[model samples]
Target: QGLRRAAKVQAGQKVLVIGAGGGVGTFAVQLAKAFGADVTGVCSTKKTDLVRSIGADDVIDYTREDFADRPRRYDLILDIAGGRSLSHLRRALDPRGTLVIVGSERGGRWAQGVDRALRAAMLSPFVSQKLRMLVSTENEEDLQLLGKLIEGGKITPVVDRTFSLSEVPEAIEYLRGGHACGKVVITE
Candidate 1:
């Protein structure tokens, strides 16, 4: 909600999601659509259909193409995967665009999310785009909205695979392989 609020997602703005098939990215896509923005999702070739199924107006197969390199610019970017460097992501955005960096893979051992947020802040003053990190606090009202969307069939959680409690090792391996179509949930 912070990103959507800060960017002021309007009825016709263009939003880009870098990892549309993942957990947070999936929510980002739906929320953007619900907020009335035209959303474009970027995921691997294997997740293209999954991204499209969630109401993204466009899905870019990152395995085959760099959506960021395209001539099209976005008004807001919810970068769920910090795969691209700061400068590269900025290139895909409009001069006054907002970049919401929400990935934590780079900071290996400690305070992963914090490190990314700090880096974004450090690079902010020198750039034209409003680069920042997102931190969502789920409240009752928003959860109610999310619940309504799920119950109403406007949004659905994509479960890539379900694993028994004893098979957690295998589930971890599956996620590490990077081919899981959606969320790998472990149920008792």
Candidate 2:
């Protein structure tokens, strides 16, 4: 609901996907492409080509410079890492742009994303631009839709590494290291 409402994406708007090489980010880039938007994916140097191969029109290497420093504005900014502050994010947004704060987990042993989402909700009421916390739910229809998109070649999932189900603890540790370029799935 948040994505559909905030994005209201027309056929030709520009979307900036921060952390576009991660799990949700990979999908965000592809879906934005399928939605007919010109997608710019921001990631580290190593993931630049991966971002483009997944369907982003452009890829920004975040390790080299600050994306928020650029004068170029975006109609929609989907911030997944939550590394950038709200003020910094607003600077890159168009006047009435939508900001979707997706999973901001920094892989802390204790969770960090929930705090950011709470703050965004409190600050949103006074803001002119749409500031939203994306609380996603497991829905059969949405899953089906995603599957269809995958089958249609409009979207693809990037799994960086897979760990055996018995090694779930090790998988969590690896994710906490934050070096994985994509998702670390536990396979049965």
Candidate 3:
């Protein structure tokens, strides 16, 4: 919904997915391709191949290269990593593009990473680009659509690791470690 509804992604548009190897990033890369957008993914060195294999037209290794330094600009940028500043992200976005900040893990306890989103809202009107934050809500219509996509083989989930129900604490720790290449599941 963030890609289609918020960013208004169109076919043939250049899309960039930051943190393109993690849970939401993995899905974003595939979904962007499914939407017929030319997708570029930014991830660590180890996840480049995974990102590419998942249908990213270009994969940037953030460890070795800065995507903002490149000449390429994106029509839509999905920032899931939540590490960079709005100014830094805008450098890679087109003048009239949309920047959708999905989620953030860094912020003070008061705002809990929502400060960036709030700042984006405050700065949006003054800027040419559409700087917005996504607040997604689940609905049966969207869920059914996603189910169809999954059933039709348009989207494939990547599960990096699975732990038993008893190991929930360890699973949480592993996710907190930020080393998961994809979703970490806790199963019975």
Candidate 4:
């Protein structure tokens, strides 16, 4: 929804998905490609291969390279669970591009990433680049679209691991350790 509705992804446009190996990032990468955009993914070194295998045209290892330092700029950028400063992200975004922040787990408990989103909203009117925050509201309409996309083989969810119902604590720990390459599931 963020890509299609918010960023208004169009064919052949360069789209970058930060944190491309995570749960939401993996799907964002696939969905952007399915929408006919050229997708670039940013991830840690350990997840580079997974990102590429999922159809990213380019994968940047954030450990070794800063995407903002590159000469190329993206028409749309989805910052998923990333903590990069707004200025840093803008350097890699086209002047007229759209930047969408999705579910960042940064900041303290009180503000809890809302600070960045609020700042973005405040700064948007003055900037040429559109800086927006995506707060996903689940609805059947979008779910149907996702179902069709999945049925058509345009997108595939990557499940990194699954834990039984009794192993919830272990599952949570695994996710907190930041070792998951994709979605971690707790099965009943």
Q: Pick the winner on lDDT between candidates 2 and 4.
A: 4
TM-score of each: 0.88, 0.89, 0.97, 0.96
Predictions in order: lDDT: 0.82, 0.81, 0.92, 0.91
Q: List candidate 3 segments past 4 Å from native.
A: none
Q: What is the lDDT of residue 18 in candidate 1?
A: 89
- Model 3 compared with the native: what TM-score? 0.97
Residue pairs in clash, model 4: none
Candidate 4 residue-wise lDDT, 8-100, digit = tens:
999999999998999888999999999999999999999999999999999999999999999999999999866788899999999999999
Candidate 3: residue 152 lDDT (0-100): 93
- In model 3, what lDDT does residue 143 have? 84
Selected candidate, larger TM-score, 1 vs 3: 3
For candidate 3, write residues 1-188 as lDDT tens digits: 88988998899999999999999999999999998999999999999999999999999999999999999999999999887889999999999999999976665566887888889888999999999999999889878977888999999999999999999999999999887998999999
After the best TM-score superposition of candidate 1, give how far the Cα of residue 45 lies from its true spot, in angstroms.
0.9
Residue-wise lDDT of candidate 1 within 13-106, one digit each (tens)? 8999888898777888888888789999999887888899889999999889888679999999888777577778888999988888875665
What is the lDDT for 61 in model 3?
Answer: 98
